[model samples]
Target: MASPSVPTSPPGPSPSPSANPEGFCALSPDDPAYRVFIDSLDYLTPEEVERVKAAVRFSDKAHEHQTRLSGEAYITHPLSVAGAIVEWHMDADAICAALLHDVLEDTGVTKAELVEHFGQGVADLVDGLSKLDKIEFASHQEAQAENFRKMLLAMARDLRVVLIKLADRHHNLQTMAAVRPDKRRRIARETLEIYAPIANRLGLNKMFRELQDTSFRLIHPMRAQVLAKAMQAARGNRKELLSRILESIRAKMDEVGILAQVFGREKSLYSIYSKMEEKQLSFSQVLDIYGFRVVVKDIPTCYLALGALHALYKPVPGKFKDYIAIPKANGYQSLHTTLIGPYGTPVEVQIRTEAMHHVAQEGVAAHWLYKDAEHSGADLQIRTHKWLQSLLEMQGADSSEFFENVKIDLFPDEVYVFTPKGKILALPQGATPVDMAYAIHTDVGNCCIAARINHELVPLRTELKNGDVVEIVTAAHANPNPAWLAYVKTGRARSKIRHFLRTVQNEESAALGERLLNQELHNLGVQPAEIPAAAWERLVKASGNRSIKDVFTDIGLGKRLAAVAARRLLAEDAIPIAATPGSLTIRGTEGMAIQLAKCCQPIPGDPIIGSIKKGQGLVVHTHDCPVIRKSRSHEPHKWIDVEWEPSPGALFEVRIDVEVKNARGVLAQVATAISDSGSNIEHVSMEGDPERLFTRLHFTIQVGGRSHLAQVMRNLRLIPHVVRIHRTRLEMEP
Candidate 1:
């Protein structure tokens, strides 16, 4: 692809140089920082350079009165960010956006002004990097989450926005010492939790390590200091050993007629700290603190180098991974192996082509840095684009939920699995077949009924392992189950499932709500179809709802009372009769619109009442339930008469308490008896002291109704060791 270009322009007037007593340079053309920033743009065409200079001048003018906490001119921060962008070989527009990024948020400059001076592309990039500071939020966390969501969505549209934002965060972290102690810690925590992980996800290893180490130092200064000292001492002790290993690998590669560039790699302090923390190991126990990277001419040479190294030292079994064949989800490719070094210390080695090395360090940025078709980061770009597109899929979620899902996606310790057709799919560790189905497509996920691993039927919740052949069996009528949410590991799967469920719930709730409202209107001597549009407009306005459907949804979700809504929809003088409303019939298929109360376990043929709960829809309870009896007196308006349809569509779960003798086979006998009675045990728990001769076994079982429950109790009582058996009712204080 051809590179982006910009128009040439003459330089604008320069501000006079000034300096503080502490030697901080003011905004000026003569500033050393500005000169260095200009020098770094050497890769850009002269015309592009001039355009970037224009942005610098504009930013300098806009931030003339502002200064950073470090006492330097505020323009220096943007200049530093732009310098990083230049180093990454970003196009002229990206550089300009970097210079003007803070102007929209920190100064009086508007996006319109940016567009007038620069271009819409530059203005959009700057706007994307800006925070939503002008809007009100419920808390600081919400504000931050919202700002992050905005930036990520913007990044989905233009990847340069994140590149510029990451550079901005990098500069801020570099000068964080001037910030207050508490503020520094907070910024460091956010950086470690969000930004660093994002950098890693984008395959920006160089930036990722720097961000992680800097944040670690700021967050835990003492621990960082101690770890630094230890690493330094360890480095000195291992220098000679690393040198010997490097020489041996080089000599072996030469003997095998393979050309390679070998160098020792030092582990970052944050990496060491994380290893120690995660593995519960002492400093000395952390092996492979130093490793080697072998960059060769081609893919074949990479494998040859790996073989040469293994021949020099005994290879550690189960410590080798060939990522070149199945690259990581982030598109990192290499061959890695651990070996016993000269003194038996474990030494890790990585083998890859020179092009892979550049990608391993620069990640997606390599697309700009290395434009050659062979060396370009096209694979990484494609992977990144797909992930960015998923951000759009997750847009309808709340800010906090979106932020959380993105965080989960950023940390993918992946396992590579195969489809039946031989295509490979990478998923997070502990991911289930549902995650795989979703990764394929949202429609596939919605219709997946079961999965077969290697042609053997397996549970949909089974955790996928490396090299497993996962074939999802989808049916047109199948739908995602709420229970799948408990085991699905990928954020894509989780968000997709939630979005589908929410969509279904809204539709179901609206239908149920309309029915309830219509029943109420009938009792009030009004027909829903006969209600005028003017009345609906008034009802929507009075209820603070956006539309008639919204009002119905509120009533369905129990946020608004259907009776009150029905009265509001009628003309003021229209109500004349005061008749009792008929009980609403529930067949237990209301989906999210109606929930069966666990406290009472009301089944078919039971006298049930419905309680409207905010955000939770209607909850059904047996009329004699202790919880209902206690709360009915306090909130009579929320209770509505409900009746069961002659044939309820689903089984009801009921709890039974069985006291049994402490015998080896007594629990099994009781379970078998309940099974013989045609009841399915949902859960069973043993309570009371084990030493007692008698213990209570609580069995939560699914039954058809009260008759089936009675049969189950009788069967359990027939067990020889059963002391007593009865249906259980749990009561809660009002």
Candidate 2:
């Protein structure tokens, strides 16, 4: 499923191109080497062909000095991709864009110039394919993730964008031998996992096949060549077997009143090797030989043809899929079955109407020509839009998550289920109901509570399967829990949940901001009306914001520092900075008596001590005041004179502690005596003994002076459970 399998066989007689292209697909429009593109222009309008011709002319001129590895003009590569676009029936701009896809990267053509010449659509398309090298990342993984994210976003805007990109990659991969070996391996590995699968999803079967084959050749050149030789040696008999099978099916269908086209499909080397490596199968065990598609006239005839096919051969059990009823996510609808033939050999058969055949092969590309087809019947437009919407959803997702989801969704294996209304929904295998919910509607994903799979309630995590009728039960007030993100598999689900979570987080944080602002206001002891409008202006100006809302948002989001905001607001003359004990000292309440304590110094950590001077109402200092440091420095107005009190008769509170045991009820017993003495424990500090036998406790308590403190100490000494207790806040020997 990870391989570049054939999504659709080439319709008419045009030979399907190899997935990993051949050497530099000789794309020069002037040259006859790549006229296959013009010959394959079976679906292009006259105007579209002219646009392609114009693209070729511009590309040839721009790449005048450029040459490819095979000594061909560089324009060949763009022309090569443009040719593929013609086959896909992409719009004229897409064709032109494909031809000029590499212009901004390979040539010096600016996006502006391209827009001026070819229009914005073509320029944007070319720009989308252009690699991003402007930013530096710490790792290649990060860079790759970002690049892929950019590509998907652009492609989501326009599917033709990625189409051009895929075409560009296809040509480069085909000619990767011209690159260094290590580079070749990187490109091949990336193509195998990403580009090739995307090709399959788009139903560009020819491109997908060639991409896988080319990757196998470059990535596993030895194995690829070996497989090539093996297929070569064994091809004669395989072709004979295929011919006999085709003849049998054709004759049988003719007899059954069903006209069908049957052709043999040889599996690509990448696919065969993948089967060998992934499943540990032998080459013979790998069924790469059988391929026959039956194109009928209508849907009922398609089912009829399946029966006719089964009538002719015994279908290998567990290998049948009815995609016609529940088409693939890419709008592919065919009845695929592996059948046992003569000699017990296995062959894969695809049965569909001619319309489904067009969709199966063209994928989204079919949308371009589907309505215009002479025998068109199926609703290709609707299916294409559905897949297109998924791509759009993927594009809108978190790029980091999208990268992971793409690895799963783009691969070929998929599961199709049915709604109770009989509508079919296709999803990747292992996708849960959450993925389905997201696929249905973003609202459904948010409100989904439970799901009934086939009329029985099942866990949301249940893995769905083909034709399982699912009904989702929803609640009006339901919301997406962030935890649901852990189990999500699709990009849409992940993105939807993340978006919800982000929205909720923002709302919660905004509420937190209001609370924080109110608390800070309370701490400042300032009534809302007390702060003058002029003062608010100065503060807001210092904060560098024109409005308070901006300030609140900044603080809420952690964008602005609290201390900086406080400092800016306090810069006004009316509001002065006040120091707490062991914290910065500043003036508060003019003429207030505040002294610096000699014990704790009130540097930055202490609870503040404030004493009213004779005329001053309040003076602030360190509670366990220290000897003076510098009184003033750069900001003279912010500083206030403070004196250090040595040993006051009043018991000066100080912080002290000792490491002690963490026995049960130890803290309770220590507090019992302090409660008994009726002295409040102002500040207590505790630390755990890592050795598991002790605890450290520090306390700053209100003591009446030395004599009163002595009485308190004597009381503390009476407690037998008490460990060592100190009375001083400063233990520094200096």
Candidate 3:
């Protein structure tokens, strides 16, 4: 059963509707809509109200020409927004802020005006809720994430900010029907996916339910209608079954002397539909459908109530959980049990104290809901602090992965496992041992090689079960493989691993570029100081770089090719190299004439290519040509066509020189090793004449590409007869 946060009061929020007598035609400030608008001022003082009103009036005047698709005045949106905050029982400041929410956004009314009128508190809320107003995101996903991050910062400061924003969203969701269909669906989807979840977390259950149902109706109307009808039909047949189940549980609790309030709980249609969609379950197969929660007096009674329920019903052995003993980081506590009820049917039961029930439903909002919650205990406060801080910490994290992790972590279906020390940790249904490793520590993730679940060796990808004892196995030298990233599900693991790899890549890139720079500088016969640091800065900017490190890193990563930066730097110093490497070649004109080089027979997939020549080697093509045409006159030497023959058809001639121990069968073993890789030595020479005992062997062999040659060299190096092996790619020194 889902433990949504609930407000602690005796349901004060289904407030009676106050009356408004005057009609719109009278245009009086005393009208019902205007009165409700005025009533929203509970969060503000009278002076602030007047100031905010003046700002709203100014905004109304500015937006006078703008109208909504519903044909209502644009001012109606702000009024509706104000009404939403009022309904949230929020303080007057939020109501006034909501009224001006659009003023700074849709009209020229500025944040300055809002601050001048409503004070900085309300003004800050408006500014936080407003669009970035500049710097458009690259895509919808990026925009959604950026906007969510902004709201989270606001929420971290003041809960009422999100509360009011949710109310504003509620009103808009209600009015979304007036918008165009495509736009309506998009708006409804965002509201359903994000705002409703926020409302649920805050314990604004009414808004949460309504927003979800409304958005679902618009986004998937056919599925919505189908689900509604199905639920109705299911309720009709199961109404008696539900009542009997509730009675049995309540009677059992009473008999056990556990006084509690028991009520039948019905899952939301959207939730049921989502569960079905996710798990591919039929509505009837969705076993948690018939849950009924027992709200008790205290934590001890919660356990007693659970025992009583289990006595009355057959407990589903592994499905029981006791989060109350070790509450979640979000400060939720409850005893959960799934049982085989009458007729061997499955049903879930949740038991929690009044405080836990409230927190369960209201989440972070419960810190404000209960009278003494802030002072209740240090543990609750610490947990709440951790919860808020976690959100802030997670905001700097890669959001796409963070949201996914949160969904799985907060998902209604959870499996609670115990650490070796009896500490409890809740993981999603399919989380693996590696997920647990990463949860332990980022270094644990870096060194995780395998896991021992309950002291039995298991694969890193083994899915975890409730109550399983898991221990991670690590090697001192182990490191994260890119492949591990594919199977890792949790955001913490994914983000940590990605961060590790990115850091490694950056270090490697810097190191690699440093090496290349030294080599290139040496080739130029110029001291490193020949070009001043200022010149490097200018070269970076002329090449559109934010940092020299960025430029060098890009060059190392092949993102910014070496030739571009080399030419830029060389040209700035008035060096002799061409302005660009590929400017021209001697042999070709602006023509389609190109031919392959027979020397290397470099094929497409051979990691093969050609280089530009200033005078003679124009349009240097690889043995297998593909580039069909080129700007021949454009420093025609720059052009090259490349290809690779499949499997590198012929054995490559390379010589390996090794210093050997001169042991028995040394020459025979080396020859056998070379031939083992499908290559034969055509010639061999020995150094260190027979008496000295130390010897050298040079074997000429055939092989494929550099990889095969490396393998052959490795095999020969392992032989006892070989002390060292050296091979080099032949190149002519300038």
Q: Per-residue lDDT of 394-505 in model 2, one digit per residue for the tens?
A: 5545556668766756646777778789887777778888889888899999999999998999999888987788998889999987677767777668777877766664
Tens digits of per-residue lDDT, candidate 1, 1-734, equal: 21322222233222223212222224667778888888888887887787787788778777888999989889888889998988888888888889889998998999877776676778888899999999999999999999999999999988888888888899899999789999999999999999988888888889999999999999999999999999899989888888888898888988999878888999999999999999999999998889999888888888878878888999999999999998887778899999999989999999998788888887888778876524448778778889899988998899998998888788648998999999999899988999999999999999999999999999998999989999999999988999998888888998999999988887878887887898788777777789888989999999998888888888888888987888777846467655777788888767888988888788887789998788878889998899778689988988988998887757888888898888888888988998899889999998866578889999899998877888888777777889888777779622
C-alpha lDDT values of all predictions: 0.85, 0.66, 0.64
Rank by lDDT (best first): 1, 2, 3
Better of 1 and 3 by TM-score: 1
The segments of candidate 1 whose C-alpha lies over 4 angstroms from its true place after superposition are 1-25, 372-375, 541-547, 573-577, 659-678, 686-695, 710-724
Higher-ranked by lDDT: 1 or 2: 1
lDDT of 3 by residue, 442-481 (tens): 7887999989888899999888987799888889898777
Task: Judge candidate 3 against the unseen true structure and give its global Cα lDDT, from 0 to 1.
Answer: 0.64
Give me the candidate number with maximum lDDT. 1
Report the error of model 2 at residue 274, Å: 2.3
TM-score of every model versus the real structure:
0.93, 0.69, 0.70
> Whose TM-score is higher: candidate 1's or candidate 2's?
1
Question: Which runs in model 2 stand beyond 4 Å of their true positions?
Answer: 1-30, 34-54, 69-71, 89-91, 135-139, 236-241, 369-378, 390-398, 405-408, 517-559, 569-734
Error of 2 at 470 (Å): 2.8
